[model samples]
Target: MTEMEWEGEFDPMSDPEEQRHLLSVLDSFRSYRRLAHFNGTHVRRQAFYSLPQEHWTLLSKPPFSVLDSFSKLDDLIDCNAELAEAIFKAGFRAFLAPTLDSDWVASVVPKKYADDDFRTYSIIMDNMKVQTSQNDMEKARSCINQFYREWSAEGAVERSKCFEPVLVALQHEFDMRKEADPGLDRSAVHVLAPGAGLGRLVFDICRAGFSVEGNEISYHELMASSLILNHTENVGQFKIAPFALSCSNHLSRTDQFQEFQIPDVHPSSELADAIGSKVPAHERMSMATGDFCVLYSQHEHKHEFDAVATVFFIDTAPNVIRYIETVRNCLKPDGIWINLGPLLWHHISRKEDDEREDKSRGRRDVVDAGISDPGSVELTNNEVIALVEHLGFVIITQKFNAFESGYMSNPRSMLQSSYRPAFWIARRKPSSS
Candidate 1:
């Protein structure tokens, strides 16, 4: 069987649904200005307008006038608009660039070219359109905050707490393997990072001299990561006020308006520097965009990876057992599987139709097939380990409350939330003949 590279870019003609989804995501970015204007500006201003006339007089004069505050918000909204434009353009370029092929060109060519079997095409961004929804706008806003967690220097502390242990474990395993096999090549140490949202961990693994691939299923994540991983050229190249939209949990207005520079490290330059000439940085790291189970369970992928690293990912399954089975099937004999994150169980409350939508997006669940109901088998940490053993894995390392980390948290917000997640490393047992 031929190995499928799985670049994750869907062909527009063949996969119209995915194309529509991509366009909708792009439209969300494009609608940022309108949404921000209505939600941020208009709503807040209306509250101010409702105040008594005497109170208005007090807010109008003084060290900081109400108009002055509104001016600052307007400016912040403009900055967000600029960032949204960049995101939309980057996503457009990344997703559509691959479609400039002979077949695609022939479809849009002139009559003469069509008759002669010649091909010509021009990609017009204006011609492609999609309407944005309230849901899309909300996700777009969330995606902006994700940049803080994934790329900003201010988020390094949280990322270090969550990612450092996984990195150390992988490196230690690599060192032990090198000691056992003196001729082992770092390039041959293949690692797979499933549900690699925004790809910070994947970049770290590749920098540690291991060939890595990141897999993600969210269009929001995939589009944003494409811009950062592929198009970014410099450190701190973009600035964003991630907390600008939040109206609560602020000790000071300065905290609310705080701006952060994104991509603390330039992905391409840093990866190139670390990997050197042994393998091109691009070849050392890649991203596969699809469901983890479906993509990795294929014949060509069986026994294909030396290690699989999952961070804040596994709990997304409706049937976590299927996830365990897929991990076992994809790993070579005695291959390692490292996991970190709490048992949040994303699909616990999802309706049947929601489960079907997930399956359509490549996520498989027993609930959709009538084999189980939502949250039917939510397991405790020990039960999860027991299930891992039952599915042909031997626990190598396990820990509870491994680390405290925040996801997309605002440092200045008065309310702070965190997760004290479980961490483990398991080895797939050799198959019995």
Candidate 2:
């Protein structure tokens, strides 16, 4: 999932209030251009990487709340220019307030984290502002790299990774869906994660009783993901070789990479002996390597699996259409689709309507250009739904947590996303039903 795609799978909710929240998100988030804002107080250091602004506003939407605590900053800032400062400020206050007193803000900040939470939060904050003077698009890349570095240094290899928070959200949604409909063929459900990073989510998917297949562009991420899967009881390792290491430096967590310095046998006799003692063979982990988009034949195996999913992926794809279509092609006619992520289209086009339209400004351009480029491809709320419907998927439930301040600790966190918390669960359009 690239800039135009919605990769992360969202947990489903059947509550009318939740559904209303989803629709509200769709309505409010339609135009996110204004959402990409700078902290004027930081002057040259604008963007999410700059200094925090307690007086700043996260967005113009609903769920307004001040980010007074660090726990609130993640929910506060969207992936925008103003995120860094908000998180840093909120985190500093959250974990070290008593020490700072009135003189704290005036003194040079300490290098070490007071605790793990503050460390994670601080890393996220410091990394966000690493950009010296690059455009927003480039800052996105820079900040992402910075965030990963700090996250990994804090021992994200096995914990506190984006994988866990995203997966926890995914698991919650998955369980809710299962409870809502027990007839979806619980056994042997297949999972597809196109850009499966470290593969933690894949592990979770497999652990949830669904067989998972992943397509990562790099050998490094694939290897890291593979190591995790291999050691796990029920999972699989699928990749296209040479885990993309160029992007490795951008990612801060390297503990897993350090562990899997050598790729081992997939379900090898050695691995078998290691795992057979615990998990059964039938549920043993599996892995593959290849372009996931090329799995047309795998998709042709009709009724072979129940569903396909992506996480924090679709929104990053350069071609959102191809991404969605790819998932559609893989899923059984009656399978379900889920995603979780901020609708990041506004950063691309600064226009909500672009998201629904066949807007293809070029995904690579996003990586090259800064986040402020107006020529990006983004869709409006109506467009996202239309696009999903066009893909022949029926939305069964949706939830919008765009307004939830628990997401970040920024002034924007106080502002509501027009459609953040924009989560939806859908089923393939049954031909007869």
Candidate 3:
């Protein structure tokens, strides 16, 4: 999925709503930027290195000129000059130290700005005064309110690393299948995507003219995805800036601020046209929320789907063998299974209490297989392939790809992740009976 290119310039003076939204965003960002400057100077001695690396690499190099976008604002104060003066006028004021106060703002800020010393006060005010296109200033203000948009459907980082590869693979498999079988019904081809985050893949598949469904387990995510896919209209271009690491040394909680957006997914012309031309997205694609393993066991779905695409799923279960079995049973004879993700085992343990809890929650199939442990069973790539073949699957294509992937990881930490995700397309072996 190609990101929507930045279109016409943002005219803040033209629209009052847009103007209000822009100022509000700028206000918040100024506070955040000031906080970063403070940490860069006092707290994090290596802030230049320790800060979150910019994901959206700008074309223009550093020493960026002031954006013409914000030049309209008449009252402006240079932050650099004020910051230098603050360094000179240092001992005059005490920074407002965070406290164990009840009024915690966003769980990151422990104290109110009202209690800060002169140094902290000056920095905040200076940030509010300075306006430039340097850093993420232009992109940030351009797409003001969209910072919290879902990454699966909108963010740049996820689109490049996750969605793009999956889309290409799906197209490759479809083309191959159609070539091998001239009678293949392209329009009627049905694919099931388990653990579809925000329905981006499913939506894109539908955009490519296929029948698709997405299955998710998290209620909150399911609802959110539904609202975004079905209710929202014509919002596409968004950005993701993971700059929350400056708030705290150790990331204690999920950083919601990191995923903020501009507007929201500005779908490519192809995607937009497909979505606009087809039956409403909500009607064209289906989203089911529940355990995917239990989905096939519901009696009527055996060997039902034409294809099963699992991206970043599979390892969610304690027994991935069960997932293989489920896929085998769910796919029609010679039906394909496309999987792409690391074997990052999610199940930590199968303690008696955990087993009881699983059963109570209707996960009766979670039985101990007498492996190394109940839940910590991890299989190598070769072992997984062997097990798939044993279950009567013929590997069509297989590949090992390493991609940078981090699920809202701390932007300040040197901790980067690379998932050596294995991609495989296997077909159910025809029954000999």
Give the candidate number with the greatest TM-score.
1
Clashes per candidate, residues 3 or more apart or on different chains: 0, 83, 15
Question: lDDT: which candidate is best?
Answer: 1
Q: Could you tell me the lDDT of residue 175 within candidate 3? A: 82
lDDT of 2 by residue, 192-301 (tens): 66666655455455444555666564222432343333332222221111111121232221211221112122333333344212343234334444334434324363
Better of 1 and 2 by lDDT: 1
**TM-score per model over all chains:** 0.86, 0.41, 0.55
Per-residue CA lDDT of model 3 for 1-433, tens digit only, reads 3321111222333454333333333333343345434433434333333544552123123332112212211111123222222322221111112222333322433356546544443444353353322322333222222223233234556445655666676677668887988765544567888887556677677777667778765322343344345434445322333433333453332331334432255333335467332343333466665567666644477877888888888877677777888788778887888888777776564345434433433423444321122444688878888988888899988878656665434444545555667888888987911
**lDDT against true structure, model 3:** 0.51
- TM-score for candidate 2, residues paired by index: 0.41
lDDT of each: 0.75, 0.40, 0.51
Model 2 ranges off by over 4 Å: 1-187, 227-284, 296-304, 345-377, 402-421
Clashes of 1: 0
Better of 1 and 3 by lDDT: 1
